[model samples]
Target: MAGSADTLFMPITNGEIPLGEGQWLYLGARAIDGGFPDELRAALVCEQSMRGAYLDLQMRGMNVSPRVDNTDRFSGALILIGKHRGENETMIARASNMVSAGAPILIAGDKTSGVAPLRKRIAAFAEIDGSLAKYHATVFWLRNSVDFASHFSSAKTSPQGYQTSAGMFSAEKIDKGSALLAEHLDENIRGDIADFGAGWGYLSAELLNRFSPRTVHLYEAHCASLEAAKENLSDYDKGQISYYWHDLTREAVGKKFDWIIMNPPFHEGRKTEPQLGVQFIEVAARSLKPKGGLLMVANVTLPYEKTLQQNFSKVNQLARRDGFKLLKAQL
Candidate 1:
């Protein structure tokens, strides 16, 4: 259990903890360092702040919550938890389940990714309020009942038609990059293909229709994204597609691919972390078979060219317009 003096929870892979005793509790999304305000350290310095927990649902890879040997129990108290699942649509589903089972909820995350609407959606089950901070806001709720699964089950966004949880990025409509990628995909991008950072199967759907690949692998780190991605791709014919709710960076060892497509996330929440893009390129190069190709789309400002050049011997500019660049590299 986290005390008021402790800023963040240690770490855990994918797991749960029994509730503990306290007046005010804080529950964070997966891991400790990745989600929290700079003020978080200060926020945990109060007596009430001693009551906190972390819900780490990331399937695998880089964002995997740190594993703690023992989990402290929450003995039924007012607990606040944060929610930031990197474009995953099932966060609300997880939160709702908690709130319904008698846990007070506190949500926090970036506004650009629909945190406000998630607060409203989660409010359907509890008393919710929000507060603004530097990069994101913290929303809290204390309620009697909540329907965790239903709040997320009814809504669907087409680009791939996955049921969306409120906080997932670009949930309102088709993601701009996905739309652009779908528009430009060629009929020849066949064979076993992979979507690195594949969120909700948007681009995968387009590839399935355009190339009819023998197998389409959708890899996402966050469990919510993995869930939504699976839900979206489930509509397609079985056996032709497979989904892995694991970190693409640490996906099953020795897994090889023929083609990889991605619009890798450059930012982790509000921070401009270009390392994510570079990491994706590195992973793509390692995952591809010899002569296999990797296609990527990113904002022109991002320095992906150097990363691609370092990873692949043949890197070419496929398209460059509208502040976005499409690059292709082959091993």
Candidate 2:
């Protein structure tokens, strides 16, 4: 329900307000153009890797951070927010917490994305000053009052026996595709292993509980999800688990892994792009040691087999159900 990038950036392009000089934090900034100011020291906080990569390519000389968690404390500056479904309330609370009192906050999104409701919610903590409606998108500005401690304090728990937060993929329950992949995971998975795009430590926890691997590395892009993963996996052997807040498409770990498990993301926003999965496969091939293996799950209709064949010496389908396929590949 989010508007196009152009629609979201219309206010900035139209010269509504000058993006002053300072440390600016951009929350949920998907791939957009023309709104960014060149003069400001901007840091973009995006949860999706594809959009982060695209914004990195477009915005040179800007700091591109992965996610906006509670630990991130910035103040006395402007914060731009691009609203999206499932994460609006969390984001507003986070923004209220991060920005200092009297700092400006700007929010832009389409009507379908609940911008009006968000405006109502934000009004409780900040005073709305100005707004613009154009191209089916609404852009509004407010000043933070620093009085929102009661709205957001703890993470949400799921029936799957793990902690998750708003905006995480399948936070309410275990994803069917992930469940399918976890069921077919090889019991012989040993040595150091990595899970790309790990969400809330589900697969990593399962792997550690089922196999006697020396170490397990979990790479996740969303800050809330990674924090929840840390909480969910706290009871496990701490020395054997590692958590990274990283964008897999741009950053790579230094060493190769004995095995890799992935549920690579395939969408930029709402649009499906199989190339994202293809890029994951390419990265997996490069990050694996000689004869190392990869276990992946994807939609059955996605053309990942061709990319797998090109990247690995062997590729085979291990299981398929409910329009999803579990694949195993080795070099």
Candidate 3:
């Protein structure tokens, strides 16, 4: 599978297609790249390029899409395939730091999202495989499962710091509606900014310590919260913060923002899909610049303020409490 020739099947979004055939599947991120069912794109075939993976529908507000950009066209064993339990502990900690010890590692997902309690905690030592896919469920392990550094160690969760392993997503605290929308940010939010779903980075460190934005793109589409927001924005300034795994509702980062903070991710995991917060309020009003603004937050009976007033003409709520609210708009 170098520069590419053939043999790259890759389909697993409405899964199935495996009985037998020339095997030319390529439907990732759940068919038609996440929006699914465009007649399964005529059951696809003639492939030259078809890459996609999931979760970035505006910061882990996933619907799946992203996985085939051909990262150097791999060449080796690092099997941690399938399932989407918040991307299986950052795909098993980057497949145990890029496999190299007896290789062949595998782990699948969707067994009610826990992969059956993570295959009953990596079942003894590996060689485990649980199947059942009426809708979703799978697990397969090999790289000495129980000794993958003793049941996958490394765990740190603070008042929202970083370091998380063993399947992500609220990997312990700091997500109470994103800490109540990071204490209602808005220190009058200055220039270039963005934090839409910057999950494990705690609202991009509260918008870089209270609206210190000159540039702040924590975009995130969950590769374990963009690897914990790139180690929590790695002590800032690589040009005033940057960390984009992308997927803010299908490509459009034409770059143009005055501010775009968000707590907008009303369930895609437990299934409450408020149209994934109205597709991140219509892709944050097409990546605002005009009247530039979008301070969303949700939960207080999520309808998303009539789709943020039909995609940001101007909607406001500012703050609420317990049930959650926040929501400020402009564009």
lDDT of each: 0.57, 0.72, 0.56
Compare the candidates by TM-score and give the number of the best one: 2
Identify the leading candidate in terms of lDDT. Answer: 2
What is the per-residue lDDT of model 3 for residues 152-261, given as tens digits with 9 covering 90 to 100? 64455545356554334566666677777777776678888887767667777767866577788777666555666677667765678777766677767778788888
TM-score of 1: 0.64
Alpha-carbon RMSD, each predicted model: 8.8, 4.6, 17.1
Error of 3 at 272 (Å): 4.4
- lDDT (Cα, 0-100) at 80 in candidate 2: 35
Candidate 3 matches the true fold with a TM-score of 0.29
Candidate 2 residue lDDT tens string, 297-327: 9999999999999999999999999989999
- Give candidate 1 regions above 4 Å deviation: 1-162, 250-253
Better of 1 and 3 by lDDT: 1
User: Candidate 1 or 2, higher TM-score?
Assistant: 2
lDDT of 1 by residue, 1-331 (tens): 3331122121111112223333223333332444443333222211110111112223212122222111332222222233334323343443344333555444445445455676676566566532333324333334435565654645554433456654455666876666666777896677889898877677887787566788888877655566777777676756978776565544452578889999998775467888889988998888898899998888888988988988888999877767788888998
